[model samples]
Target: MRCEIPILLRCCFCFPLRYGLLVWAYLKQISSISFSTVMIIKLCHDYYRIQASGAVISSLIILLMILDIAFNVLFIISAHKKDYKKMRIFYRYSIAVLCLNVAIVGFCIAMYAYYVYVAPIMIIFIWSFMVPTLVMIIVMVFLQGYLIILVRSEFIKLKNNSQFEFVNHGADEKCTANLDFVKEIPGTV
Candidate 1:
């Protein structure tokens, strides 16, 4: 009965349920305009004005989103089977990827802000273009490394806990057997 609760919770958190919510939210955000159309236009405009290669970045962002959606769906299904270990790994990976997406979005927003405030004619060719691009690249690389470390640490902890549980259970069984043997050896005390 005690173990059943965790299993129930795990089932509830499965991929389809979680991914369905994500798909709904994404649809809501893009209900007014097509996602692809906006993405293409934004990429082209950024490429022309800032001389930043926006197409590749934009495509990468889209691809990440698709992967996230698919993983969430898979997670929901996996959880239903009480696969907590896999669920944990899936969530950790999702979080790492989500952090990367956030960094990319932040970089884009920062660039947009710079362009809007700084006079384009004065800074566009040099500072506006090169500075943001360099900064974004550096920050993205650093953040990606950081997220990878975080995920690895989490995996290690999970593995350690499982090992500890296995050892503890074995010890308990051995102790119980010893106690039963002592009981059977009556009058030895």
Candidate 2:
């Protein structure tokens, strides 16, 4: 049998709006702020040696991040309102932002590879960070696909059951779908 804790935690964590907000916070704090600050510091210390226009690229990345944050906030609001059509549109926008982020990460990786193989220049910061960035980007792309699948399944469930009942397991195995005493998310109950 599947562990109840994992299932409960997964269900809670898979709540799309909350997940979007968590991702937004991470991107704002770690990727946009800390990462950019360190890169800027590196550029300032080695302006002549690092000739890859790091400042311009970082600015573009920051702009993309800002767009992503805006999309995520809009998605959270739509989800909260239980407006299916609006949620779908905002989710698509989030997916597009993820695609752009993946592209930017890929470009950064390619630049690192070029510096290593073609240019014979060793930018320590770029080389050091590219690996982790690539891995995270790949994971984010997969997550985007997973979220799409989950949303599609939820749509089907909503269509088949007009009541939109959702079961919440709390210290019990019995399905709560039809239980009047069981509380659930507003739109799904």
lDDT of 1 by residue, 1-189 (tens): 354211111112453433433343355335323564576677766765644455667877666555655665555444345444765766577566657667766776676677768766745566666666767766756654443443344344445555654245665654334333454555755
Q: Please give the distance, in angstroms, between residue 10's alpha carbon in candidate 1 and its true position after superposition.
A: 12
In candidate 2, what are the lDDT values of residues 83-166, reduced to their tens digit?
Answer: 566556765775676677678777977787788886665667566677787788888777665565554444344335456577
Q: Point out where model 1 deviates above 4 Å.
A: 1-62, 120-189
- Candidate 2 scores a C-alpha RMSD against the true structure in Å of 17.0
Clashing residue pairs in candidate 1 are: 14-76, 15-75, 15-76, 15-77
As a TM-score, model 1 comes out at 0.35
lDDT of 2: 0.59
Worst 10 residues of 2 by lDDT: 3-12
Best by TM-score: 2
lDDT for each candidate structure: 0.53, 0.59
